[model samples]
Target chain A: MKFEIIDYKDTRSGFGEGLLELGAENPKVVALIADLTGSLKMDAFAKKYPDRFFQVGIAEANMMGMAAGLTIGGYIPFTGTFANFSTARVYDQIRQSIAYSRKNVKICASHAGITLGEDGATHQTLEDIGLMKLLPRMTVINPCDFNQTKQATKAIAKHKGPVYLRFGRPKVPNFCPPDCEFTIGKAIQMTEGKDVTIFATGHLVYPALEAARILEKEGIQAEVINIHTIKPLDADAVINSVKKTSCVVTAEEHSIYGGLGDSIAQLLSRELPTPIEYIAVNDVFGQSGKPDKLMKHYGLDAPHIAEAAKKAIQRKA
Target chain B: MPEISELQAIASQVRRDIIRMVHGAQSGHPGGSLGCADLMTALYFEIMDHDAKTFDPDAINRDLFILSNGHISPALYSSLARNEYFPVSELATFRKIHSRLQGHPATKEKLPGIRIATGSLGQGLSVSIGIAQAKKLNKDEKIVFCLMGDGELEEGQVWEAAMYAGANNVDNLVALVDYNKKQIDGSIDDVLPLGDLRKKFEAFGWSVTEMNGNDMHEVVSHLKQVKSQTHKGQAQIILMHTEMGMGVDFMMGTHHWHGVPPNDEQAEAALAQLEETLGDY
Candidate 1:
């Protein structure tokens, strides 16, 4: 693996742009926003398709229920809000109207993870992925970068069931292959190595890629896999990659308690009991600070992932 | 207005269906079903103007009715079937395995009259608002009607929806609260006091109305008067007062029959008191 200093872009911008495109391409694609329409980068969609856009005015629960009903009359509804307001604030609404009834809805959340910055613990929702993944029919996607997030937004609309697409505010590097195809449950192997397998999602995927570059300098072979779809996990890809590497490091922007790491651990524990280590927020809420400082405090930075990978490799050996 | 004798006959048949269906399946919320028998009968027999025989599930030109308090599915199912939405014989399959007459109202099993799945409280009003908004957007003249439980209003989401409906002036919607006073746990006042429902609706910018939900004549007259209240830049809220279990002698006064199945003897006794006005399934 080789290190490359890449240009960065915010994934939220990707989601907003994609939403506008969906609105243009399909008249049925209607959007609903809470007060964070500008923050979620949904202003473009809201401006261009004003009739199709609904300003829900800080009422996420009403937005969710209305989205469910909008689907009844054949509208492909996309609900935009902060990750916290989209999930935790309206878990029952999403559970009963959307997931339980299996409505065709896209719940696009922005400002996920510690990268949300300044707004603090209340806004930084690391537990959203865990809460959404527990839903039976929800397709949870925490894409790695701008391109991947945009691809996911389009992909989820074509998908018939409920989807939870999470993206962050920070301007991370746009490093994925520009024209790469995106299949919802398929894991993309960003870099391949032999010593350890690193499975990461959301903002952590970029960090894992960084750690892979750092490890290569030390002659430590690391295989980086982006577990984009958290719910219908790319199990075969994970297991196959883990078998080659013989050790695993699972990373995510969510809590270590019940997010991607937990799902991967559950999978490896049952079939292939590999030495697995995690890089995620521990049982604690984040506070107002720079995104980098918050990520470090939560133990979810590239250095933390690099250390976790080394630990897993040593444990496996 | 529908004749009192005819309305009484429909309600009697609906009550008979409620008792038999609950007994046949050994499950369901008979208390609320019996409680809303007159309301359902009034709506189907006289209030909602629709051609029941031509059942278009999403007919844009026809009026839409939603049972937000979906636990009362037996009453709704009986009303729809008797109006010929489906074969009335399907009543025998209530709550049984592979039956379209699910414990709650559902559209999943291709149930003709059910527009959406409901059982989880506080969601139906929001859905009804969405439907009403759609009707307005489409310039459809038909009204959207939804029935909700007084207890179901305790859900915070319901209030959120109420706020949105009032703010947006969703005038095409008519929301009826079954103010039966009793809930599954106990009386709503003991569980959680709902202070002045009509005032709350009025504060929320709704045209509030109250009616004796058990009185067929009042139900019919109020429904007609409320239609004039529609498209007036405000939503309509009807606080309907009724007993929890209205038809059966033993079940009427208490919340005991809320979700309890009637035993064979209890079923027979209840049925004997109510005549087979439209014949049993």
Candidate 2:
């Protein structure tokens, strides 16, 4: 399989672009920020649609509750904040007002995982996927690249219910096709192979693709599938891909617990038993460093995924 | 509008319902419920222009009320029922398994009058501000009223929401505090004193109004005045004063009944003090 690299861009740009488009297309789309407009790339949307944009001024708890209230008046409110503050600091507010109440709130979080860099462990959130997916009626999406994130931003607006849209701050290789359409709860098959399956999400998808290329040179055809939507896991896609491969390796820039890997392992353990390897953080806090160095140190780069894929293949029955 | 005497008769029945409901559940907050009975009665029966039969969660053009301190759900449930939001007999199922009335006010069961879930304190004010802003965005011109316990003011998020509403000029909102001066452990002064609430709210850019919440006529007239003050470039908050347990004799003036329900003989004695004008459910 061949693909073209479009450019190097942060996935948050995709969110900003998609939000800007929504501002023009849908009159009811409102944007709320807790003082991180420039970082989240919500500046353009806030400027273009000033009336619909609300700056809550560093109060995340109030922002979450206000977002829940905005839905009561039939408005689609997208709240922007850092991943840590978005989930951990305001968990009760989200639980009572947004998730349990079943408010049509889109909780768009930026600077997810250690890729946020330099900000250290306090700013990075590796437990966000687990925290969000645990709540009933919550749809969690962690898009891979600029193109996919943009499409996902537009997709969640059309799909009603509570959604946690996770993205990052670093500029990675934006290889996904610009025209690719995003569908909620559907997995995107990047490359198909027959020996082993490499399931990846968020910033780790490009590395998984690279890992597949490395495995191909060693006479191993590793399949790479993008599991963007974590909750409502695409069971058919996982089962079908694993049936041919018979072994699995899940990769993500999140903690090993309650991330994409756990979701897949739980699925396969119940449906079709298979040996699995998780390429994620081993339940530890991240440190301040360069994003690429952090990825390498945490064993989240391409070479690590390739090695994990081989280990998974070796363990298959 | 109902006459003052008529509203008082409804309040008397609402007080009786509060006692009966708490006694039946044996596990609800009755002190605050009994204290806010008159205010709740005034809001549902006369103050709010709400359609109880055709209750819409959106509440579009109607006045919306949120019980922020949801532990006192007995009062809200009785008021909603007395206003015909649901069958009055349903109040018997409070805090039971497979019942719509959870320990707290929740929207999950699709209860007609509840727009959002509350029990976790300090969240309702923010939600009410959000609704008020939405009404402004939609040009609906409807008022949003939120009732909070004085003890509920200790949560930091309340002030966060207070600052936001004041800064954003969320003028269509009317926030009221059940200033019973008592909390579960002890009085609010002993726990965490909210020094000079009127000055605090005034400092936060709210036009403050003080009223006796237990009096039916005062509650009705003050709420009406607050309603007329909406869309006037500042949010309004009424610091309503009342006893911890206002209606009942033995229960008044203490925080012990804040969550304790009356027993069999105690319920009979409490019922004897209050006249059941509208007939008990």
Give me the TM-scores of chain B across the candidates. Answer: 0.97, 0.98
- Computed on C-alphas against the true complex, the DockQ of each candidate is 0.53, 0.85
Q: lDDT by residue for model 2 over A193-264, one digit each (tens)?
A: 999999999999999999999999999999999999998899999999999999999999999999999999
Candidate 1 lDDT tens digits, A251-311: 9888888899999999999999999998988888989999888888888878888999899
For candidate 1, give the lDDT of residue B244: 86
Least well predicted 10-residue stretch by lDDT in candidate 1 chain B: B53-62
Candidate 2 Cα errors over 4 Å, as ranges: none
- What do the candidate models score in CA lDDT, each in turn? 0.88, 0.93
Please provide, for model 2 over B83-192, each residue's C-alpha lDDT reduced to its tens digit, 9 standing for 90 to 100.
88999999999898888899899985799898899999999999998898889889998889899999999999999999999988899999999999999899889999
Interface quality of candidate 2 as DockQ: 0.85
Model 2 local distance difference test score: 0.93
lDDT of candidate 1 over B146-169, digit per residue (tens): 899999999888888898888889
